[model samples]
Target: MENPKKDSKKINDLEQNYKNQENTTLTTNQGVKINDTNNSLKAGERGSTLLEDFLLREKITSFDHERIPERIVHARGSAAHGVFELYESIEQYSKAGIFTDVNRKTPVFVRFSTVAGSKGSTDLARDVRGFAVKFYTEEGTWDLVGNNMPIFFIQDAMKFPDLVHSVKPEPNKEIPQAASAHDTFYDFVSRTTETLHNQIWLMSDRAIPRSFRMMEGFGIHTFRLINDKGESHFVKFHWKPKLGVHSVTWDEAVKISGADSDFHRRDLWDAIEAGHYPEWELGIQIVPQEDEFKFDFDLLDPTKLIPEEMVPVKIIGKMTLNRNPENFFAETEQVAFLPGHIVPGIDFTNDPLLQGRLFSYRDTQLSRLGGPNFHQIPINRPIAPANNNQRDGMMQMDIVKGQTAYFPNSLGGGCPHLAKIAEGAFDSYEERIDAKKIRTRSESFNDHFSQPALFYRSLSQYEQEHVAEAYTFELGKCMHSEIQERMLWLIAQIDEDLANKVAKGLGLEVPKSIEQPINQAIGADADIQKQQPPKKKIYLDKAPTLSQANTKFDSIATRQVAVLVAKGFSMKNFKKMTDVLEQEGAVIKLIAPHGGKVICDENMEHKVDAAIMTTESVLFDALYIPGGKKAVESLKKESKFIKFINETFKHCKAIAVDNEGEDLINESFVKDYKDDKAVFINKTPEDFVKAMAKHRNWDRRTIVKNIPV
Candidate 1:
């Protein structure tokens, strides 16, 4: 009768305490002790060192070969280890044990990466982000390797090499490190008609996500879901963030790259360390197999998307990342994810890109991991035991003891026979494929402009303007005039207004008309041609959800807020405001003239997180300049401090000032000091806290002028 659950919790807590205390460190590879590590062994203190210095030689040699070659794409990445818990069973949809068990929890590892960057590139690069999740289920490991955008730039895998070559740094000069705004990329865009939809997304806010946790992920290609009854349905996978989608402005993103190259990685690590686990809801869009051709676009086309309005995403499960990797190289770097590494109950569709990826991933891993035996690595090994007649290769970790290596041998007694269908053995979906051998896109895959136009027309006015601005900025960097003109003409085809707006920004004239051409293939199905253009379906009257502006903006959790203070700052008001905001899950940092402790009027000193010279306004979400007669007076004389406040205001972020601090704003010639929704003066800490939760003030952009270029 005496609460058994409480007793069990107490025992578990005691065990955890003992585990926490069992930690030790500091030893060389040979278990040798070195007292001084400040400097390596040298001759006569500052002279050239000798080879006899074993410790110095060992340390330097190890450091030299520390890094491995990064991925060809998705080179810049961040990762976390977590577990996925099923909320309910969907046994009718599939026979996979993980999906059919309501109370089961499966271990998972997720990696988020930028597509075009090198390992040392900036996190805020305007590139597609890879969202790859690997699940260790009871049957085998399943990898859902996807990207933040639901669609891709190419329809077939054959064009992948060309697409990557154009987007990467130019072969001759490698001038840009992690940028797509180049002549080669633009040239490819003009020729590849199927890339139109993804090009629009690239120009949208989706390209520059504020953080990995705030972005949505998609499987990109169509897949099949077969239930126990052998019934198949085409499906698309989605991972919607619980905190909602958010993005930084182009100017801010550019500044942030210089200010902090690891901005997104730092955000994710800090959130998990602070106990703010990022969450995402798993959703799927289902289309009956018989009705696959009912849609205007072909299901096999990777460049097209099935609008959510036509086939709504059904939310089924949730994945939460609550832990960070213990070692960057051992866990995050060595982890290999393949689209073909799927378990039972999950099968592939006949999408050409997916088919090519199935072959490319395993082949690439052989060279990248140094051999075919990469699965023997601890990070890549399956949790479910692997048993087969397959033998040794480079880096082989296992030894099979059997007289006969071949299957169906009498010496081995025909052992290791195939398991029954009831067992969790993988079998491809039994959909019939009776078509003649061909290597061309279906006729239904012809239309590439309708969805791009729909996406352009659905955005909010501010978002639409940003897209236009992004297109102008990217095209402006191109040195070739013809490339720019060709891209502008393509944009005109998608939406004439968008083309004109971008042209105006670039100081060029919009083309009066653009040419359209009929299909002429160079592959196996060269005779294929459409008699009519693909019809556009009316998905929504206005798809507000497609825009990042319509996402959630209520939470200020993990948001960095700058509190400007100096000597003789108010301790009472500072503590009061920070306490409430901190309780509401905001991160507060004090910025002063120097990084040392600042003395308050109440005789309390507080440590400054950063000094004015080292910290910029672009690094924070909002600014709060607290009140103190002396503190405000000191800040008013400092140009850097004044510019910091002005720039924050210019960025349309929330700004709060106390009475004494408000006086300094009025004296400064930033703008009219009229207190509005953005500029809060003489407000209570509660009121200021509420205002900061809105993320940013979109209305302020309309009034501000002479904004930073």
Candidate 2:
């Protein structure tokens, strides 16, 4: 209808505009072409990161300021007030009061979060979970900011911004929120081989944890523990949950997101409110400085993890989260954590990622919480007194009264003077250094394929199947065939069978070779051979601790059991099963056909927690349906009740039924699965409790995958 010439001209102008802005070469904000944006400048290949590294500063600074008012990563979070009690003093390794004082019950504030989501994103996203703990010690504040996974995607901190930008929603549309199953993410991951180790971990069940209380936490970076004699030992911190590491299937995770977006947040708060405090034992893998190079992997490589089989974890102390925050904003939202917040007995390592994080976290807080004075907030305040000469910032909550505000002042009588080493003054470890400054990672960090291979090999049979299925789902979501093919090749490098399975699921073939080399994460002028990962190696047959199959399953504390009932239910059967469950600390919720109370066969009124239509099977850990002829008939009328039973069986969760309750199960997909080990019919209450404690009958996964529910 309009002018054809004008339309052609507009198209021509748009093409010209795009051409004007096109530049294949990567550059800084200042328009300086970068030869190497992959590595931070360091003293040597394995030495500490240098302060003069402008490239690292610019990239990290930009990433830190990218989001304001909310954290750039770990935006959606929940917090709790806790106490860390020392089981025994390890003064031989460290002098920090929290670590050495057996009697001190150090107060702590812990925050759990999902990394790739906004402040409002769903809790069940398949992403890394942040497990950050801040300990208020007598000497100073110590923060162990870590994740549920032991390793990260990249090695050097210089590439962090690029990694985040790729995994985040594409800039053009921002369509996929809090998800990594996309074209940009695969493109980056295929090129950057270092991400494969953590990438495989994401595909595992660990990404979708059952609860914050049940997942293990890792410091991710190697840190140093300083003794009173100034001896240093490389240490990796671990938090072993009392409830054992467990995860929901990808199916259950998806359904839980829809049924209850705040599932995890509510689980944590409700557990604490009901006096079922969550607990974790602090463990550390300590390696002497003399034995730093004893392993095949570099201690400073953030992308690599030391296998538990190599260095055994020594359980040290226990932490119990007994209280929830009163105000989300005043406490959970305002609390700040910094890796630099260490006491006298703790010191930093030369790990490049850790070095960069020391600067990035503080910088992020400045933009997020207004200014440097965020530490003055009540939740983040230290148990030890803080006195300093620097003053006057935005939101300066402290009032410094003095005749002089400078250090070593005669007028103030040197009131806030520094203390000596013997008087608990913090000091950096005296690790000797003699090396030329360079921009490259250690050769030890180049073996990217071995650990990922080891991880895949360590998983149980069913766990491996889940990994393959997860990869299929994620890669299938990508629009580019080239990206999918590249990822398939990388997966082959990890495990050939895994790659083949995922490839089949995607209706594609694993490429024999690709146009570009396997690793393109190196610099433009860097030696390609040096950066490329070598053929996969077998370090050990398997690391048994890496798999959840070996985790503890001794108790059923805080397990949620959904009880399906209606009017004229058997009160005797209900009380018999619930009594033992409550004694074992399991939470019992009644789901009925309606919201109001239902009268049992004994004419006793029982409160209904929710109507059957309001809750899903994914919300609870297990199911119990007591026998009652009228009640069974009522439940059979509601179609969702059949779905509820079918979905529970599909998830492999434990299900128990009494006389007439068996009739209800016969009407659903669970009828065919009645003989399942976790499915108890007229079984003893103790036997049912034992089945529930096993978490799920994972063997049933082979049959349940075909369930329509």
Candidate 3:
């Protein structure tokens, strides 16, 4: 009834009140004001964590239950059934049967996943890959849940929720999917200096692996191995892929996401189904208990790794994933892994992050898989007899025979009794822990910049350039100038050249100083300046193992090779090339102008794998075109064929053409690269195989920048 202007003003005020949070204080869902949420409550600065930490429980519980059925972090996953065969017994290191029994073929289930994405997100996301393995040994089910990166963004498990929240899509506007090139992620990474080590890893090509079979897996945390003599030694786990480490370029990753969002998932399933099983050697780096403090960095720090140059990996066994899951929802979806599921010889360490995970993983499964009875699921059940007195809950699939639901009951004749320590029973490692309970981290974990600097310096020239470009792209997306400046300043601490490269790309200067206190992981009353990361140190000149350039290149098994053909493709040239390729276990896919069968020059009809517009160049590892005048003429009419060849050259993949096939290459951007080392012209099939085995012609990346596709 009042003036119209008054009504409009009232409506605007209401909108601001409901949407804006400028002056609001951060509080828990229960309305409890929190002062420090970065570090969990521990026994001492570096002692074992305490269970009285309610803040950690509440925050992680909320995060674990945020989504129903699908995992909150590693939502989109692909898994397989495998078997682990020990090559040699390491009886001196551990008493675990899997480590000591060389004749045993332990059954295993492995799940590979991408973090910071939903169940429906694209597989080619530039994000951390989750590499979790569940080993069903005679002792028990040991779950070695880890990631593709050797380190993580945060040091403590307490900040895991915060880390995931920052990298996840923004709540109000879920615009970006399966990506970290956004504002909120970098804002958190810049403030949390501990994240710098693993942050540099995410900015590298390792985040965009070419295939799940080609990427390495890491335990990421230090664990203790107790021998039969009760001696404890600190150890780290590594999984070296038999196919070697490989990755795609950022440009290729972008296009691949559009072309085949299920590239990795499909590749893995096809390889296993085609009898080309993926294999990875299990390796361990064992350090004596007395030698733990010998390194420049803390062994317990989750954000650092012991350089392989210092301690070489001792290959013990191999794991071969020879079978695909029968049902995705029943096996892959409902499978639960718990870090606490360890045998007698394998035990936990006091790493704060690992300490928190022992609780977090089990808690997450309780909520995700319905209840405590999830272990009864066929995929999660242990091989050894589970004679516990535990009772029913949601989704209880087991039926107990006796009426005794409690232990130490004579009514059930105490039949489900515990085994003695001598009868292969599990025993916790008796590590000494005498310290006061406190909510702080050790000073040893403060040197965050040193390892990141070492990692950047260790990379090859091409890898380093990719890192710079990645940083530039990620930071350039940030709208806030202050956040970008802060990141530029931090990157400068790692390397001046890298920082300058990113800064130049962003059209901004690398600031000499930033106003905010660096490293916000300190407690509410702790000294901020003391917790700040120290100056970057150069412990080693380079770790060659850090670069994919030094990976194995002896085989090209399961490599997808695209054979461009038409109605009159050269059967002679095709046979010569494909015979050698198939012998080496490379997959040959025929791409033509149209689908279905096409007749060759010899009047033989062959099936088509994909049509010109139906497939993309980024989906294959190499390209081959057989010699045929009619084939070249038909290929020239299809514009996508030319674009496909141009993209193959742009990505620096191997390319080979024979006789008139060169005519097709001449029509595309590959014509200018006649002298390129990996671009073969009328070459022998052995020569082409040799080039394809190298994965890609990385040197060609520098000169092919101007190629239009």
TM-score for model 1? 0.87
Model 3 clash number: 0
Which scores higher on lDDT, 1 or 2? Answer: 2
**Residue range with the least summed lDDT across 10 consecutive positions in model 1:** 38-47
Candidate 2 deviant stretches above 4 angstroms: 1-24, 516-522, 527-531
Pairs that clash in candidate 3: none
Mark the regions of model 1 whose C-alpha exceeds 4 Å error after superposition.
1-68, 513-539, 667-673
* Per-residue alpha-carbon lDDT of candidate 3 for residues 415-526, written as tens digits (9 for 90 to 100): 6887898888878888777888888788788888899999999999999999999999998877667788989998998998999999999999999888645455577666
Going through the candidates in the order shown, the clash numbers are 0, 0, 0
Predictions ranked by TM-score, top down?
A: 2, 3, 1
What does candidate 2 score in Cα RMSD to the true structure? 3.5
Please estimate how well model 2 matches the true structure, expressed as its whole-model Cα lDDT.
0.91
TM-score computed on alpha carbons, candidate 2: 0.96
Candidates arranged by lDDT, highest first: 2, 3, 1
**Residue 603 of model 2: what lDDT?**
96
Which of 2 and 3 is ahead in TM-score? 2
> Cα lDDT of all candidates, in order?
0.78, 0.91, 0.90
> Which of candidates 1 and 2 is the stronger one according to TM-score?
2
Write model 1 residue lDDT over 652-674, tens digit each, in one string: 78887776887767765444845
lDDT (Cα, tens digit) per residue for candidate 2, span 570-680:
999999999999999999999999998989999999889999889999999999999899999999999999999999998989999999999999999888877899999
